[model samples]
Target: MTSTKTMLTLAVATAAIVAAAPAAAQVSGIATAAPDSAILSAKAFGAANTQIATTYKAQLDQATAKQTALTTQIRTILDTNKDGQISQEEYQASQVATNPLSGRVKAAETAGQPAIDQLRAPAVKAQAYAIEQVALKYDAALQAVVRAKNVNIVLSPNAIQYAPPTVDITKDVIAELDRQTPSVPIAAPANWQPSQDTVTLLQQYRQAVYMQEMRRAQGAQAGPAPAAGTTPPATAPRAPTGR
Candidate 1:
């Protein structure tokens, strides 16, 4: 599991590497692709995702609603201060039997989790199937990109320290994949299954999507930026920067 998680971190990063060989004073023939990114970024994957979102809206909504309600219930039980919020101290207290309402708090979580999982199963399966379909074309699309670009060597970004955007062929591979398979079935057939590796890739993709959503939400909550050249509302002063 640790190895899988490590792989997920690497796989989610876009890959690029410098060229090993150069002709005279000029350098060329280097390209890179994060196969996982290529597959996930393909138009087909995004299109299929829209379909999955539509198909599983009810289930996903139920899971989200249940989760939100569970959080409120826990806070209501544990917020003995009646501060209308659960602090770290209160939250920790709820986990142990010492708190008078710990049992009810724990029970709510225990009962809510399985129901939420059941609600989420369909969307998760559909997403996995879509990822598998796009992943199937990765090797071919990569090879095609290599041949067209006359790439000498390609490497994963995780395997190296840094690379320039010009050498990263991820977008090219994504375009190739879009051409090869414009879309795939969002529904998995009975008895259909993905490999363990594809399952891990699905997990990684979900984590990435979750993070993006969080950043977006945070940005929205931050409100619009101050107008250019105008004095902004004051916050804490920062330390001076170095050259």
Candidate 2:
């Protein structure tokens, strides 16, 4: 999941709201402090998510192709009767018979998982680290801003009205992160099992594709059933009978 800026917590009710008066009025007493942290948070989270998204796309494509091929192979094996199809009963029975060796299939099912984790895990960890680094930078910058304004409490942008352009600190935080971190690859686990969710989803998808093919083959074999009540035409007579 993508990260988000921290939530705002401030009492805006007691704060003064400045309404525009005639140009002659002098503005005074209203105070505001911009949220540099929120800006930094947005930038850091956005960059991390973008990197993660690209990684996820590649992993998803690879997994999907592998799954499609395996489904076709499994379906061919299951429809063993070759009457062009298998009934649900036939399919279930075949699976049961073959189920004794399912450990092999499970191993295969688990094979692609490491690649997926290799793409996803590093992205997650990198984003987490980047978030921490950026937060620290934001706090340091914020303290300076606070000391300059002599404000003890600073609320996020959502809590205030009309912050000056100088108040946003996101760019600085992003700059620091960009300077310190580089994109890194996720390493595969030594013995990571396939995610159950991914396995289950692929299984269901393959089952649907298999069922469709079975139905199509059945349709082809079902052709014209002996033309209603008429008996099937007999084979031609043997030549010269028993000469």
5-111 per-residue lDDT for model 1 (tens digits): 34445544423212232443123665556777888889999998889878888887777777667756666777779876556676666657675677786677677
How many steric overlaps does candidate 2 have? 0
lDDT values of the candidates?
0.65, 0.40
- Could you tell me which residue pairs clash in candidate 1? 15-157
User: Between which residue pairs do clashes occur in model 2?
Assistant: none
Quality of model 2 by C-alpha lDDT = 0.40
Q: Which stretches of candidate 1 lie over 4 Å from their true place?
A: 1-27, 88-105, 215-243
Best-matching candidate per TM-score: 1
| Residue 196, candidate 1: alpha-carbon lDDT | 72
Residue 93 lDDT (model 1): 64
Candidate 2 lDDT over residue span 86-130, tens digit each: 456545554453563344344544663344434344443433343
